[model samples]
Target chain A: AQKVTQAQTEISVVEKEDVTLDCVYETRDTTYYLFWYKQPPSGELVFLIRRNSFDEQNEISGRYSWNFQKSTSSFNFTITASQVVDSAVYFCALSGEVVFGAGTILRVKS
Target chain B: DARVTQTPRHKVTEMGQEVTMRCQPILGHNTVFWYRQTMMQGLELLAYFRNRAPLDDSGMPKDRFSAEMPDATLATLKIQPSEPRDSAVYFCASGSGTDQGGYTFGSGTRLTVV
Candidate 1:
C-alpha cells in the first residue's frame, strides 16, 4: 500500500513572500512517482511537477522549487515571491497503479 | 497541444437518480484515470484503464459505481443510485504510459447530489 501525507491543511502568506508546503509519502515499491498539482478557484487541477524515486536532485522552475529527500521521504515545494494568483489548493500525490493524496490549501494575499 | 476533454461539466441530481460522466483522453495516450475530489477527500482514484483494458478499480465502490472504457478514446463512469455523499467534482486524467510526467487532466465534472 502507498500513502501520501500533506501535513499542512491550510497556509496563508502575504504577497511576494515565500511559502513552503510539506509532503511526505510511504511506499514499499523501489520505483514510484511523486507529483505536485495545483487546483485554483476555478476547480481545474494544474500539474506542477513530477519526480521519480530514483531522482534525488532538487528542481527549480521559475518561481517554484522542489526538494526531494529520499532519506526523510519528503518532497517539499516552495514558491518564491508568490502573487495573489498563487492562491490555490496544492496536492502531493504518490502513484503506481493508483494515486492518493488529501492536499494543502495555500492562500496568497496582497 | 493535445488535451483531455470531459462532458457535462456540471451535474445536479436527486437521490436514486442515475448519473454518468464521460471523458476523452488525449490522442495517442494509452492510459486513462477517473478520480473524485471533495473538501474532505482531496482526490481519490476511482478507476483506471490501460490500452482500453480495465487495469485497477480498487478505489471504487463496487456496489454503485462502474467504470469502463468501451473503446480507445472514450471512458465512462456511471453511478446507479447516487447519494448526497457522492456529490463531488469528478476528474478524468490521461497519461502516455506509467511514467511520472505522462499524465494530463481535464477540468472535471462537478456533480452535486441532493
Candidate 2:
C-alpha cells in the first residue's frame, strides 16, 4: 500500500513569512514519483513539482523550494517570502496510481 | 493549450437521484483519472482508464458508483441513488501514465446531494 501524510491541517502566516509544509510518504516500490499540487479557492488544482525517488537533490524555483529526503521519507515544500496569493490547499502525493495526502490549508495574510 | 475538460461545473440534486459527471481528457493523452475531493477525504481516486480501458476502480463503490470510458476522448462517472454523504467535488485528470507525464487536472464538478 502507498500512503502520503501531510501532518499540518492548516497554517496561517503573514506575508513575507517563510512557511514549510511537511509531507511524508510510504511506498514499497523503489521506482516511484512524488508530487505537490496547489488548489486555490477557484477549485482548480495547479501542479507545483514532481520529484522521482532516485533524486534527493533539493530544488528551488523562484520563491518555491522543495526538500526531498529519502532518509526520512519526507518531501517538504517551503515558500520563501510567501505572498497572499500563495494561500491555497497544498497536496502531496505518491505516484503509480497516485495516492494523496490529506492536504495542508495555507492562509497567507497581508 | 492542452487541458482536461469536465462538466457540469456544479450540481445540486436530491437524495436518491442519479447523478452523472463527464470528462474529456486532453487530446492524445492515454490515461484518464477520476478523483473525489471533500473536506474530510481530501482527494481520493475513484477510477482510471488507460487506452479507453478500465484499469483500476477498487476505490469506487461497486454497487452505487460506476465509471466508464466510452471512447478515448470521453469518460463518465455515474452515481445511482446518491446520498448526502456522496456530496463532494469530483475531479478529472489526464496523463500519459509515465513518470514524467505529470497529471493535468480539470476544474472539478462540485456535487451536493441533499
Candidate 3:
C-alpha cells in the first residue's frame, strides 16, 4: 500500500509572504501521479496541480508552483505572496490508487 | 463547467438513524470515489467504483456502512445505525478512468450524528 506523509501540521504566515508545504510519499510503483488539493472553509476540495511520475519538470501556475523530485520522493508546493484566500488545508496525494497525505493546515494572516 | 454533484450538503441526524448521501459524477467520467474526512482521520477513501462496478471498499466499515453505484451517474453511501463517531464531512469525487492525474471532488455532505 502507498502512503503519503506531510510532516507539517500547521503553518502560519502573514499575507504577502511565501510559504512552502513539504510532502513525502512511499510507493512501490515506478509510474504514478501526484496531486495537490486545497480545501477552504466552504468544505469543497479544489484541485491545485497534478504531476506525473515521468515528468520531473517543475511547474508554475501564477503564484503557485510545485516541485516534484523522484529521488527524495517529495512533491512540495510553494505559494508566492499568498493572500488570505490561500488559507486552507492543503493535501498532497499520490495516485497509483489515490493515497492522500494527512494534510497541512495553512493560515495566511492579514 | 462539469463538476461532481452531491446532495444533502448538510445532514443532522440522531444516533442509530440511517443516513444516506448521494453523489452524481460528472458526465462521461467512468470512475467514482467516496471519501470521509475528519479532523482526527483527515481524509480516507471509503469506496471506489468504475463504470458502476465496485472495485474496492476495504476502507469502509462493513457492518454499518455500505456503498453502491446503481448507475453510471449515481453513487450512494449509506450508514446504518449511525453513531456520533460518524459525524464528519463525506466527499465524493469523480474522474476519467483513463486519467490517473486528478479527480474532481464534490462539495461534500456534512453529517452531524447527534
Best by TM-score: 3
- Report lDDT per candidate: 0.90, 0.94, 0.94
> How many angstroms is residue B52 displaced in model 3 relative to the true structure, after the best TM-score fit?
1.3
Candidate 2 displacement at residue A52 in angstroms: 0.9
Instruction: Please give the C-alpha DockQ score of model 3.
Output: 0.82
lDDT of 1 at A51: 92
Candidate closer to the true structure by DockQ (higher is better), 1 or 3 = 3
Question: What are the models' TM-scores?
Answer: 0.96, 0.97, 0.98
- TM-score-wise, the better of 1 and 3 is 3
Of 2 and 3, the candidate ahead on TM-score is 3
List, residue by residue over A1-110, the lDDT tens digit for candidate 3. 79999999999999999999999999999888999999998879999988989999999999999999999999999999999999999999988558899999999999
Q: What are the per-residue Cα lDDT tens digits for candidate 1 across B32-58?
A: 999998878778889999899989998
Give the alpha carbon lDDT tens digit for every residue of B1-114 in model 3: 999999899999999999999999999998899999998999999999988899999999999999999888799999998999999999999998787648999999999999
Q: After superposition, how far is residue B50 of candidate 2 from its true place, in Å?
A: 1.4
| Candidate 2 lDDT, A1-110, residue by residue in tens | 99999999999999999999999999999999999999998989998999999989999999999999999999999999999999999999898888899999999999
For model 2, residues B1-114, the per-residue Cα lDDT tens digits are: 888999999999999999999999999888899999988877999998888899999999999999999888899999998999999999999988754557999999999999
lDDT of 2 at A18: 100
Docking class of 2: medium
Candidate 1 TM-score to native: 0.96
